[model samples]
Structures are given as structure tokens and as C-alpha cells.
Target: MASIKLNNVTKSYGHGAKALQVIHGVTSAIADHEFIVIVGPSGCGKSTLLRMVAGLEEITGGEISIGGRVVNALEPAERDIAMVFQNYALYPHMSVFDNMAYGLKIKKVPAEEIKQRVAKAAGILELGKYLERKPRELSGGQRQRVAMGRAIVRQPQVFLFDEPLSNLDAKLRVQTRLEIQKLHRELGITSLFVTHDQVEAMTLAQRMIVMNAGRMEQFGTPEEVYNRPATTFVASFMGSPPMNLLRHAPNADFGGKPGAILGIRPEHLQIGATGWAVQVDTLEMLGAERLVYCRMGDEFLIVRTDESLSSAPDIGATIHVAPRHDRLHWFDAETGKRLP
Candidate 1:
């Protein structure tokens, strides 16, 4: 197990004025045995950053250190790290046992030791029964587990996962996520998981790093990022329906200072008698909750409510709504940064 550090790390495609910079001097300290997720939209450089840490991509500037050793010049094989990719990169011709033991065999480890390591990893991943099965014989989730098992047998200092759950179905994704959590608890290895899904980041990470447009948006626990976002991008990206950001309206007073954008989460808005009048545009009834899509003047809003409500407003009906006073957030209109 080891700590990972990125110090003013940067990446660019070309030189001079036409250079397309993708990562802009990101820096963070990940403690030993901590699970950190780098999350953002598609083109935000999260996967690029993960690949850089794995020594698969060259660093244009700054340093990357793993286990207190600077690894900017190290090859991926020499970095003491194992990577699990989005596609289950398993060999169709190899059995589960051989797949797990391949790395050890390449290093010329003793046959007995290789067998022991593969057995141990299989036991941990609940794949002991499938050791003889080839990749073609397994389900998508099972193949993913095999990929994870291959990494585990190496006992690497750090684990790098690049959207490892992307191929699984919804149910299998949830199940595999739990399996990963349990595996981390038992082994306690330092891990960095990269994904575009905010829900995955929130559920898996001890702390998450939010990225956008080649910049680090925020680094904090899921609760902190959801409750008090550092920027407008984070506020809009880290939630289920996302935070509602409305420009200052002349007719509405959100108690925000002048020239600030008002932000309210869907769950924080409530149907009330004294508040802004909204025209219902649509409604979606989830099993446990409901989403009310409405328009207040020219601004659209989504309000989450409990399913127990005896009556719901009809489409095109006017309804009153208000945001919880303490839960409201304010952001700078020009910079889209959260206002203090």
C-alpha cells in the first residue's frame, strides 16, 4: 500500500500557441489505503490523469510520485501499480487461474507461489469455483471480477481503475460495487478510480476529485461536494438531477446578494402556499419519490417530493414553491463560482 502524489502535473498535445493543453497543473495528496475517484464529464481529462499516474502517458510538466518515489520516468511495468480497464482485458484462451497467475509467471515466480497467489485472489473475489473456466464461459460481471482478480494477484502498491464498471448491467454494477468495497476493506490498498458517473464516485470514493475543462474543480468528501460545492460546475455535475442554477430575476427574491445566481437542489424545494408561482410542465413518479418539472417565469426548475402526497398538481396548473432557506446556495454570475 502507498500514498500517491501529483504536484503541479500538466499535459499538453503540442507546443507554443497552438498547443492543446488537456490537464492544467493538477495537484493532490492521496494518503495510503485511501480510495479516491476522479470524476467528470467526457472530455474533462479524468482518464488522462489516471493514465498519467499509471505511467502509461508521458507527463508534460511536474512530477508524479507513488509510494514516496518519483515515477515520472518509470514505465508502467516498473511503477508497482495494476490497472483494471473499462473493457475486461482478459485472454479468451486462458483459464481464470492462468489469467490471474500470468503476471507472476512472467516474473518467473515459483509454480507453488503462483498457485498460492492465484488461489488466494480467487478466494477473495469468490471466483474459486470458476478457476477452470475461460473468459468466454463467464458473464460480464464474472469477467470483470476476473480482471480484478488478475490485479489482486500482483499485490501492487496501488490500483488504478478506469471506468471498470462501465460494461456491467445496472444490477451487476451495484453488486460489483459492493464486492469492490469489501475487497478494499480486506486488502486496504491505495486506489484511484476514474469515471464519468457522479453516482459511482459518490458511492465508492473516500474523497472525490471533480474535474472540468482541464482544471481541478474540487477535491473533498462526497457530502462536502454535494452540500457545499466549490464551483458552479461542481454544483451542477455532482448530483442526480443536479443543482438548480437560476439567474437573478427582477420579480423573484432568493435572498441572495445582487448579481448572484441562486442554486437550490431538487430535494430542497417544496410545494408551499407562500412562494414563487410555478407552472407545472411535467411530472415523473418514481417509486419512492416524484420529480416535479415546472417553470417559474422563464426559468425551469425540478422539485423532488415524496410519493406519499395524496394529490399532485396537474400539468399546466399553477403551483407555489419555495426553497429551504438554509439549503439555498449562491454563485457568482460572471465566474460561475460559489459565492461566500
Candidate 2:
């Protein structure tokens, strides 16, 4: 296990006047055996950042260090890192055992040692029974496990995962996520996983980096990112229904407070008798909870409530809802930055 460090790391294409910069100055320190996840929307530079750490993409400026050694000029293999790609990059003809042993063979490890390594990895990943099966003979989930086993056999200082669970079905994704948690607990190898799925980031990361555009929006534990976002972009991007950002508070009657935006989560607004009066525009029942889309004048917001607490309201019916004062978030309207 090893620590990874990035100091003002950046990436760009072209040069001089025509240069298009993708990653801005991103700086962070990942501790040894830490599981860090980089999450963002598509084309937001999250994957580019991970690739830079893997030495697969060149940094335009600054430095990258692994286990205290600067690796700006090091190749991927020389960096002592193993990568698991989304497509389950496995050999079609080779059996599971051979695919996992291929890397060890390339390094000229003894046959007995290779066998032992493969067997141990298979046992950990529960692939011991399918060692003789080829890639085509296994299911998608099984194939993914084989790919992970191959990486485990390398015993690299760092593990890089690029949307490794994107190809699996919803149920398999959940199952594999559990397996991944177990793997990390047992191996304790430093890992960097990149994904567009916020749920995955929230569930898997010990610390997560939330990216937007080409900048690092925030880096913290899931609770910090979700509870107190640093900016409007983080506020609106990280949640499922997202935060309701309004230019004016409902029932204030004076348009809105100048230079400030109010942010409240869907669950933070409660239906009550004496508060902002809103007309219920729509309602969606989602298992144990319900989403109520409401309108107050021209501003629109959503209210999330438990289905067991009360019955659903009819569309266009007027209802009063109160915002939890403690949960309210304020931002600078012009800069979209959180306010003190």
C-alpha cells in the first residue's frame, strides 16, 4: 500500500494560444490504503484526472508522486499500479487461471508462485470453481470478477478503477459493490475509482472528490459533500432530486433578498399549516417516500415526505410548507458560492 499526492496537477491539449485546458490546478493528498473516488458528470474531467494519476495521461504542469517518489516521467507499468477498466478487458481464449497468471508470467515469476498467487486471488474473489472457464463461458459479473482477480494477483501499490461497475446490471452492480468493499477491507491497497454515479461515490468512497466543468468542486467525506456543499454547483449536482435554488423566498412578497440565493433540499421542507403556501403541481410515489412538486408564484421547488406520514395531495391544491430553518443554505447569487 502507498500514498498518492497531486500538487497543482493540470492537463491541456494543443499549445500556446490554441491550448484547451481540461483539468485545472487540482491538488490533494491520498493517504496509504485509502479508497478515494473521483465523481462527476460526463466530460467533467474526472476520468482525465484519474488517468493523470495512473501516468496514462501526461500532466501539463505540477507533479504527481506515489509512495513519496515523483513519477511525472514514469510509465504506467513502472508506477507499480494496476488498472481495471469498464469493459472487463479479459482474454477470450485464455482460462481464468491463465489470465490472472499472465502478468506474473511476464515478470518471470516462478510457476509455483504464480499458481499460489492465482489460487489465493481466486479464493478471495470466489472464482476458484470457474478457473478453467474462458471469458466467453462466464457471465458478465463473473467476467468482471476475473478481471479484478487479475489485478489482485499483481499486488500493485495502487489500484485504478475506471467505471468498473458501469456495465453490470442494477442488481449485479449492487452485489459487486459489496464485493469491492470486502476486497478493500481485506487487501487495504490504495485505490482510486472514477465514476459518474453519485450513489457509487457516496457508498464506496472513504473520501470523495466532486468535480464540475474542469475544476475540483469539493473533496471530502460523503456526509460533508451532501450536507454542506461548498458552491451552488455542488449543491445542485450531488443530490438525487437536487437542491432547490430559489432567487426569492416564497411569501416574502418583495421579489427576493438582494444578492443572495436560498437553497433547501426536498426533504427539508415540511407540509404544515402556517408557512409558505404552495400549490401542489405534481406528486410521485417512490416506495416508502413521495416527491411533491410544488409551485409558489413563479418559483418551483420539490418537497419530499414519507408516504406513511400523510396521504398524497391532489394536483393544483394549495398547501402550506415550512422550511427547516437550521437546514437552510444561503449562497451569493452572482458567484454561486456558499455564504458565511
Candidate 3:
């Protein structure tokens, strides 16, 4: 419901020799109603940044504003933001409806309005049939929905999700992701999500911020971040089994010219009719897909092939592989920066 802004925000802990700076002069603006996701490794300060925006953590420097007004001095409650934590924080003894309505009751909201809001939220979250059930009676996914329902009832200017799906099993996590995406579209509320899972970030975010060691490394749409990674760290972090970055030369050895440090997605490497011969090392079977591990000039690279590649290359067999030139990503080996 509100646009969020952070101007040169920073955070540091301890002092002198023991000092550690987490966020350093981070500046970004989240437009109204946009679903933004902040992604990074475990200690990258992703959650810390979200907590600062929620007013849960006192920012060490810079200013934070919500809906065109500076809210750095305001408390979390005064900011009109609802946060859903990683753990479903429902009251153990409270029923679904009661859990969702607890915040409203504390704010001295009219009982009738609270009832209306909670009921509507339960209906939206498909918990209408289980409002009478307590937290102990619900499954993990259901409890997560209750957590989401609690946030929905508040109708806050912004929604904060702090790794809300990390606890769910893989199947449930996937299911909940779709539900969240649908809920965002239906509510059209600005949401800031924090997660370390690149898959989650890729699937959920319209635009994502990649953070590293408490500093922002890159900010862009999922496609831009994947296709044109800003640095080697991002290049390695955003992919499955990661991108194969091999130190090679633009010479006649591996078929044609190659750049300094060449990055190629596994799926981009394939057996071609005309290419340098590589001695296959191992083969990985992945149901609908397969991976061929091969060696070229003392370097290892993975080639992806669909289930029906017709003639699957055998292990220890010599085969020709051509790098997908158009999809090739180049980076400077020394600086780890993308090539211009």
C-alpha cells in the first residue's frame, strides 16, 4: 500500500578491533505494490535489512521512509507494516480465527470489524473450513497459511516476509510459493521478502536484490541477474549445480576462440557435430534430464542432455562439444567482474 525507500542505510556492530560492519550505505526504492525479494547467503544481512525496514532493528545510519514520509523515528506498530516470520508464530492455544484476529483486538478495533476482516482473510487463504481448529491440529502448511492470514487481516501499507517458507518441506514450499504469488496479485500490496534460496527468489521476485557479506552486490530483475550476472559471486550463486567457469583461452585448442574466464550453463554445453574431442568422465541420470561429465584440458565441465538425446554419449567415450557462444558469459579472472 506504500512505497518504501532507504537512503544510504548502514549497520555496524561492536567497536574498534572487534567492529564488524554489516550493511554499508545501501540505497534503494521499492515502488508501491511491487513484490521485491532480497536474496543472499546466510550471513549477508538480508534479514537484517528487512528488520530495519520493519523498524524491528534500529538503523545505525541513514533514513528510512514509507509512503513518502520518513518513519525512522516511528515504532514498528506506527509504521503500519505486518511481518510474517520464518516460524509460524500462532498462539498455541488459539484457534485459527482467534490467531488472525488477535492483533485487531489489541488495537481496540471494533469486534464486528475484526470478525469481518478475519473471516475474509480465512476465506482468502482457504482456511474458512478450519477456523475452529487450533494450531496443534493444523499441518505445517496450514499453519503457515494461518501466519499469512494474520498478516492479511491487518491490511497494512506493506507486508514483510522473512523466510516464511524455509521450514516447509520441499513439496509444501513449492505449493506455498504459488499461493503467496496469487495472494500478492489479489491484494496488490507492497511486499518485501527475504530468502537465501535462489530458486525461491527466481520464482517469486519481480525484481531481486543480491547481497553479499552485508553489502548489496547487485539489484535487477531475475532474468538480468541470471543472464548478465554482475560478478563471479552472483554468477556462481544463482544457478543449479552452478555455472561452469573454466579458465580458458581464445585459441584453436577447444574448437574456436575463448575469452579469459568463460562461464557456461550446463544446459548450454552440448554434443555438437563439429567440436574438440572431450574424454567423458561420468554420467548422471536425472529422470527427465541427464548430465555428462567430461574433461577438457584438465578442466571439468558438465553437459546437459534431455532424456531423448537419441545417441547418449557413453562414459570414457570421446565426443565433440561446442560452447553455446551466444549464451556464453565472460568474466575477468583477476577481478571477477563481468566483461564489458
Candidate 4:
């Protein structure tokens, strides 16, 4: 496996009036055998950054290196990396065995060696029994595994996953995500994954890069991004239901406020005996816990509450939504930059 590095890489489309920079000057290093997740919103350039590394998109400036060798001039096939696309991209008519063996065949690996490698990958992906079936016959999850298996058989220097689980159902996504994690652990290959899903980023990455508007917003561990976000955008975008910055803002949503945004996660907001009194707009019971969407000042916020509370508030019920003082976060009112 190889360590990947990008130096001041950029990508811009067209000239002058029609020009738009899609990838800013981004520089980072992904170490050997590290599982790095690149996450951002739609149009945030996460995929573009990944495609650049995969040699599918050219870098406008600077260099990209794999295994200490500059590969900016190399073709996709010459990069020594296997990419797993968002769509399974398996051949419709080919059997799973044939699909898995295609790349090795292209490289002219011996037939016995190809069979050995494909069998090993199929066994690891739990697809050994489906070798004779075509892609259409498999479930979404199974098809995704086959796509991954195709990558595994190549035994390249790196594995690139471009949101490979996005096509599966919610339940299947979770299961496949776990399998991918386990597979990564077992294989220990340098892998870079791209996804817009924050949960996927949080769960799969050893280190994650959060991108915004083609720029690097933050690059750190999942805890570092979620707990101590470098910018307000990172704060609001990284959590489930997100942190409630409204409670800390005197006038939150409409501007002219003290800060551009105040940030806190849903889990940080709790029902307390004393705090800002709120009007409950809705109460959503989500099995083990409840979500209390309440009005704090002029802004609405979501708080996680215990399901066994003695008295659950009515839709219009007044209650107190308090934040854990130690876990609070603040940002500049106008710039949306995190306050120190």
C-alpha cells in the first residue's frame, strides 16, 4: 500500500466570465494503510478531490503522488489504484467470477493466480457462493460487495471508494458499511472514501477531511470535527439534527445577531429544571429516546430527551431547554467563523 499526497491542488473550469473554481488549493497527506473519508455537502468538491487522486480528473495546479512517486502525468490505468464507483458498475452479462477476474485478465495475470485471488476476495466478501450468478440476480448489497470484490482481486496499492454504499437501502447501508470497515481492517490497504453522509464519515474514517465550496474546511479525526469544529459550517453540517446554536443566540435566524451562529448538537440539549423556557413545537418519539423540537428565543431547536420522563410536554407545551455549559460552541455573528 502507498501513502498519497496532494500539494496545493486546484481545478477550475473555463476562462473569465464562464470560469468557476471547483477545487481550491488543497494540500494534504493520506498515510499508508489509513482509512480517510472525504466528506462535504453536494457541490462541495469532495468527489472531485477524490477523482483527482484516482487520476480520473486532472489537477489544475500542483502535484499528486502515490507511494512517493509523482503520478500527475499518469493515466488512470497507470496509477496502480482500484476505484469502486458509486454505481456497482459490474458487467451485466458477465458472471460474478468473470467480473472479478476482468482487471487481472487485462493485466495478463496467470489463470491459476487470478482464480486464487478472486476466490480469496470472494470468500472475504462472502460472495464465494454466488460466483456463477450475474449482477442482475444479486441484491443491492450483494452487488456492492461484488464491486468491492472486483477491487480486492486486483490487490493494488490503494482502494478508492466513491460512496459505494449510497445505492443500498437504509438497513442494508448500515450492514454493508460495517462489512466494509471489517474488510478494511483485515486488508489494511490505504483507502480513501468519498461521501456526503456525515454518519458514514464518522463511522468509517480514522481521519476525515471536511470540504466546503471546493476548499478544505477542516482535516482531523471524527471527534475533532464534531466536538471542536473549526468553522460554523462544520458545526451545523456534521451532526444528526445538528447542534442547537439558537438557544445561545438572542436573535439567531434573521441576522443582526451577536454571532452568525451558535452551535450545539441535539445530544447537548437537555430538559432541565432551570434555563431558557421553550415552547414545544413537536415531540417525536424515536424508540429509545424522544426528540423535542422547541422554540428557544426566536429560533427553533431540537433536543434529545429521555423517553421515560415523568411528564412529556404537549405540542404547545412550555419547557426549558438547557445546554451543558462545558459543551457549548460559538461562532462569529457575521463571518460564521468559530469564536475562540
Candidate 5:
């Protein structure tokens, strides 16, 4: 296990006048054995940052250090890091055991030691029964496990995962996520995982880096990001239904300064008799909970509620909704930054 640190790391394409910067002075400290996920929308530079850390992409400026040693010029193999890619990247021609042992063989490790390492990795990944099976003979989840097995056998100082669960089915993704948690608990390796899915970021990371258009938007635990978003982008991006960001309306009771935006989570908006009036547009029943989509003047709002109510207001009907005062989030309208 090792700590990873980034100091003003940057990446760019072209040079001089035509240069296009993709990463803008990203800096963070990842402690030894900590699992950090970099998450954002597509084309937001999450994968690029992960690749930079893995030494697969060149850093345009600043430095990256692994286990307290500078590795800005080191090659991927020399960094002592193992990566599990989105595609699994298993060789079709080789059996599971051979694929896992290939890296050890290339390094000319002793035959007995290679066998022992492969066996132990297989046991940890529950791939012992499929050691002789080729990649094509296994299911997608099994092949992914084999990829993880390959990395585990390397015993690298850090683990890099680039959307490793993106290809799995919904149920398999959930199961594999639990498996990964177990593996981390047992091995305690420093890991950096990149994904576009906020749910994955929420569930997998001890802390997460939220990126946007190549800039680091926020870095904190899931609870902090969800509860007190740093900016409008984070407020709108991290939640399922997302936080409702309303322009400062002069007549509305939801209080805010003239130039501030009001933010309220879906669950925080309650149906009441003394607040902003809304015209119901639609309602969605989701078993234990319900979502009310309504129009308040020119702005649209979504409210999450339980099914315990005896009745719901009909579409096109008028209803009053009030946001929880203490739960409100305020942002600067011009900069989209959180307001104290």
C-alpha cells in the first residue's frame, strides 16, 4: 500500500497558441490504503486524471508522487501500480491462470513463486475453479474477476480502476461492488477509481473528487458533497432527482437575497398551505415514495414524498409547497458558487 499525491498536475494538447488544456492544475492527497473515486459526467476529464496517475498519460506540468517518491517521468510498469480497465482487457488466447501469471513470468519470478501467487489471487477472487478456462469460456462478470485477479497477483503499491464495473449487468454491478469492498478490506491497498456514475462514487469512495470540464469541482466525502454542495454544478450533479435550483423570484416566499439562487432537494419540499404556489404537471409513483413534478411560475420543481398520503393532488390542480428553511442551499447567481 502507498500514498499518492498530486501537486498542480496538468495536461494539454498541441502547444503554444493552439494548446488546449484538459486538466487544470489538479491537486489532491490520497492516503495509504484509502479508496478515492474520481467522478463526473462524460468528457469531464475523470478518466484523463486517472490515466495521468497511472502514468499512461503524460503530465504537462507539476508532479505526481507515489509512496513519497516523485514519479512524473516514470513509466506505468515502473510505478508499481496495477490497473483494471473498463473492458477487463483479458487475453482471449490464454487461460485464467496463465493470464494472471503472465506479468510474473515476464519479470522472471521463480516458477514456484508464480504458482503460489496465482493460486492465492485466484482464491481471493473466487476464480480458483476457472483457472484453466479461456476468456471466451467465462461470463462477463467472471472475466472481470479474472482482470481483478491479474492485478491482485501483481501486489502493486496502488490500484487504478477505470470504470471496471461499467460493463456488468445491474445485479452483477451491485454484487461486484460488494466483492470489491470485501477485497479492499482484506488487502487494504490504496485505490483510485474513476467513474461517471454518482451512485458508484457515493458507494465506493472514502472520499471523492468531483470534476467538471477538466477542473476539480469538489473533493470531499459523499455526505458532505450531498448535504452541503460547494457549487451549483455539484448541487445539481450529485443527487438522483438532483437539487432544485430556482432563480430568485421576487414574489416567492422561499427567502434569498436578490442575486442569490435558492436550492432545495426534492425530499425537502413539502406540500403545505402557506408557501409558493405550484401547478401540478405530473406525478410518478415509486412504490414506497412518489415524485411530484410541478410548475411554479416559469420554473419547474420536483418534490419527493411517501405513499402514506390518502390522496394526491390531480394534475393541473394548484398546490402550495414550502421548502425546509434550514435545509436550503444558497448560491451566488452570477458565479454559481455557494453563498454563506
Candidate 6:
């Protein structure tokens, strides 16, 4: 395993005045054997950043180093990294065994060693029974495993995954996620996974990089990013129901600070008698929880409540809800940055 470093890494399409800059001075140090996920919305440059590290996309400025060696000019193959793409790039005609063994064979590894490597990878991925099966004969999950197994046998210093689970069904995605966690635990290879799914990032990443438009909004553990976001963009982007950003708060005190946007998570709002009176717009029952959509003056607010705690209120009914004092987050109204 190897540590990766990005020092002010940047990317641009054209040159001079018409240049279109995508990545903007991204800098981070990925420790050895760390599983870091790059997550963001579409067109946010998360994939572009990963591609730059994989040597697939050239950096416009700054430096990329792998295991203490500068690799700005290195080719993908020379970087000693394995990539698992969203589409399982498997050969239709080749069996799983041949597919896994192809890389070692091309490197002219001994035939016996190739068999051992392929067998070990197949065992890890539970593909031993499907070794002789062709790509057409395998399920989507199985094919993806084969692709991962192919990478595992190479024993690269780094592993790059570009939305490897996007094509799978929801259930399969969950299953494959578990398998990947297991794989990382057993092998402990340094991995960089790029995904647009925040749930995946939160579940799979030891550390996550949240990107927006081409700049990195935040980089931290899932808990840090979720609990104390650095900016309004992260506050709104990383959550499922998302943080409620109120430009005009219902209260006058404004959480003891003035002239800033207020942020409150849906779950933090409590139905009370002495607070903001809001009209219920809608209610959605989601198994154990309920999302109460309400309109407070001109601003919309969503309150997440446990179903066992309270019954749902009728739509169009006015209700009072108070935000937890300690849970209130303040951000600059103009800059959208978090305030102390």
C-alpha cells in the first residue's frame, strides 16, 4: 500500500483566455491503506479529480505523488494502480479465471504463480465456483466482482473506483458495498472511490471529500461532515433530507446572532407550543420516521419526527415548532460560510 498526495492539483480544458478550469487547487494527503471517497453531485469534478490521480487526466498545475514519487508525467500503467470502472470492463469470451489471470500473464509471471494469484483473488471475492463461467453467464454483481478480482490480483499500490456500484440494483449495491468493506479490511489497500451518492460515501469512506462545481467544499470523516459542516453548500448537500437553510428565521433573536443564515437539521426541530407557527404543507411516512413539510411564513421547513413519538398532524393545520438552541448553525448570508 502507498500514500497519495495532491498539492494544489488543477485541471483545465483549453489554454489562455478561453481556458475552462475544472479543478481548482485541490490539495490533500491520503494516508497509506486509507479508504478515501470523493463524493459530489454530477459535473462537480469529483470524477475528474480521481482521474487525475489515476493518470487518466493530466493535471494543469501542481503535483501528484504516489509513495513519495512524483508521477505528473507517469502513464496509468506505470503508476502501479488498479481501476474498477462503473461498467465491468470484462472480456465476453474469457472465463473468470482467464480474466483475472490476464494481467499477470501479460507481465509474464510464472504460470503456477498466476494460478495461485487468481485462486486467491477468486476466493476472496467468492468467485471460485464461477471461475470457468464467461462474463455473459455471470450476474451484474458477479461481473463487477470479477472486475474487482482482476484488480486485486495485480496487487497495485492504489485502487481507484469510479462509481463501481451505480449499475447494480439497490439490494445488490448494498451487498456489494459489504463485500467491498470486507475486501478493504482483508487487503488494506489504499483506495480512492468516486461517487455521486452521499449515502455510499458516508457508509464506505473513512474520509470523504465533498466537492461542488469544481472546488472541494469539505474533506473530513462522515461524522464531521454531517455534524459540523464547513459551509452552507456542505450543510445542504451531505444529508438525505438536507439541512434547512433559513434566510429569514421565524424568531426575532435569531439564535443570539444577527445577519446570517440559520441552519437546522430536520430531526432537530420539535413540535412545541411556544415557537414558530407553521402551516403543515404535507407529511410523508417513511417506516419508523415521518417527514413533516411545513411553511413558516415564506420559507419552507421540514421536521423529521419519530413515528412512535407523535402522531401526524393534518395538512393545512397550523403548528408550532422550535429548533434546539444548541443545534442551531449559523452561516454568512453573503458568503455562505459557517460562522463561529
Local distance difference test, each candidate = 0.93, 0.93, 0.90, 0.89, 0.92, 0.95
State the lDDT of candidate 3 residue by residue for 83-122, as single tens digits: 9999999899998999999999999999999999998898
Model 2 scores a TM of 0.97
Backbone atom clashes (below 3 Å) for every candidate: 0, 0, 1, 7, 0, 0
Q: Candidate 2, residues 1-340: lDDT per residue as tens digits? A: 8999999998999999999999999999999999999999999999999899899899999999999999999999999999999999898989999999999999999999999999999999999999999999998999999999999999999999999999999999999999999999999999999999989998999999999988999999999999999999989988989999988676253334566999999999999887888999999999999999999988999999999999899999999988887788888998888888
TM-score of each: 0.98, 0.97, 0.94, 0.94, 0.97, 0.98
lDDT of 6 by residue, 20-50 (tens): 9999999999999999999999999999999
* Model 4 poorest ten-residue lDDT run: 250-259
* Candidate no. 6 TM-score: 0.98
Residue 212 of model 3: what lDDT?
Answer: 91
Question: Against the correct fold, how does model 1 do in TM-score?
Answer: 0.98
RMSD of each: 1.1, 1.8, 2.0, 2.9, 1.4, 0.9
Per-residue accuracy of model 4 over 270-322 as CA lDDT, tens digit each: 78786668899988888878888888667888988778764578888888766
Question: Which ranges in model 3 have alpha carbons more than 4 Å from their true place?
Answer: 249-259
Q: What TM-score does candidate 4 get on C-alpha atoms?
A: 0.94
Task: Give every collision pair in model 2.
Answer: none
lDDT of 5 by residue, 92-173 (tens): 9999999999999999999999999999989988999999999999999999999999999899999999999999999999
> In angstroms, how far off is 208's CA in candidate 2?
0.5
Candidate 4 ranges beyond 4 A from true positions: 247-260
